[model samples]
Structure formats: structure tokens, C-alpha cells
Target: MVTAALALCVRTGAGAVIAATVFLTVLSVTLGGSVLADTPLWLPAMPAWPLTATGARLPVALVLGALLLTVSTGLAHRELSRAASR
Candidate 1:
């Protein structure tokens, strides 16, 4: 949904979104793994976390999804308004 909003409302290309998503996911996993492994990180417990703790990731995901949804709704609303005026 986030990617769709970026592609549609923000006018980003699908290919660009795919490429960026792949890159970011790889980067996130690498950094997160490094942090979890206790390697020398600029910020300990970073890059990787919703957290390694038990039962703590869902709320973060939910909040972030809600925020993204809100923004997407606003964009969609604006788009609809523009279409209506035309």
C-alpha cells in the first residue's frame, strides 16, 4: 500500500519503487543483523530494530501503517477533488 501510494499519488514509477525497496530491505537486514550480532556499530541496536525484544514489533508496524494510510488517504482525497473539478 505504501509503495502503491508512492507510485500513484507521488507519481513514482513502479520500477523505481521496486528497485528502491529491494535496496532498502537488503540494507536494513544487513545493518540489523550487524547490530544484533554485537558488532561495532555507530549506534548499537539500530538499523535492525523494531527490536529483538519479545512481542514488541506489532505496535510499531501498526502505528507506521496507520500513518502511511493517513497520508495515502490525503493524497487520494486531493486527487479525487482534482478530478471532480475537471
Candidate 2:
């Protein structure tokens, strides 16, 4: 997704960024994972605080969020570099 957005931006302009941002925001809000239950898909899940009110799942959320952000950042960085080069 990041790569596609970067490619589009490189080819086009900031519109790609807005479109991609909207798409990702929608995707995350609609399809984001939940740590409260086990999902069949490997996609990240938003954590359910009701199930983990004791703060046990806080670490899980933090770790997963960090991991997801790290991966996204790396991919975005690579794509941005590629876009900048062109």
C-alpha cells in the first residue's frame, strides 16, 4: 500500500498522498485487528479494553502497534526514497 501510494505520488502529485492516507485511515478503522479475540486473518486487530481492563494487554497493544508502525515506516521510507529519486 505504501509502495503503491509512493509510486502514485512520484508519478502524480500530493493527491496520491491524500488518497492513500484516506484509504489507509479507512482501512485501519474498518479492518483494524482486535487483541481481544483471535482472528483467522493475520492482519492486526484493535485491542478490546474490556477484555483487558487490568492492563495486561497494554503491552500487547504497544508491541503490536510499534511493530506495525516500524514496518510501515520502513516500507514508506523505501518508497519515498524511490519516489524522490525519480
TM-scores, all models, native as reference: 0.45, 0.45
**Residue by residue across 19-65, what tens digits does model 1's lDDT show?**
76676567667755654434333123323445432255546555755
lDDT of candidate 2 over 1-86, digit per residue (tens)? 45546556666688868976776556455544344243422243333322332356567666766776677667667767877797
Which residue pairs overlap in candidate 1's backbone? Answer: 32-48
Worst 10 residues of 1 by lDDT: 38-47
- List residue ranges in candidate 1 displaced over 4 A: 1-10, 36-54, 76-86
- Residue-level lDDT for 72 in candidate 1: 73
lDDT of candidates 1 onward, in order? 0.54, 0.55
How many residue-pair clashes does candidate 1 contain?
1
Clashes (N, CA, C under 3 Å) per candidate:
1, 5
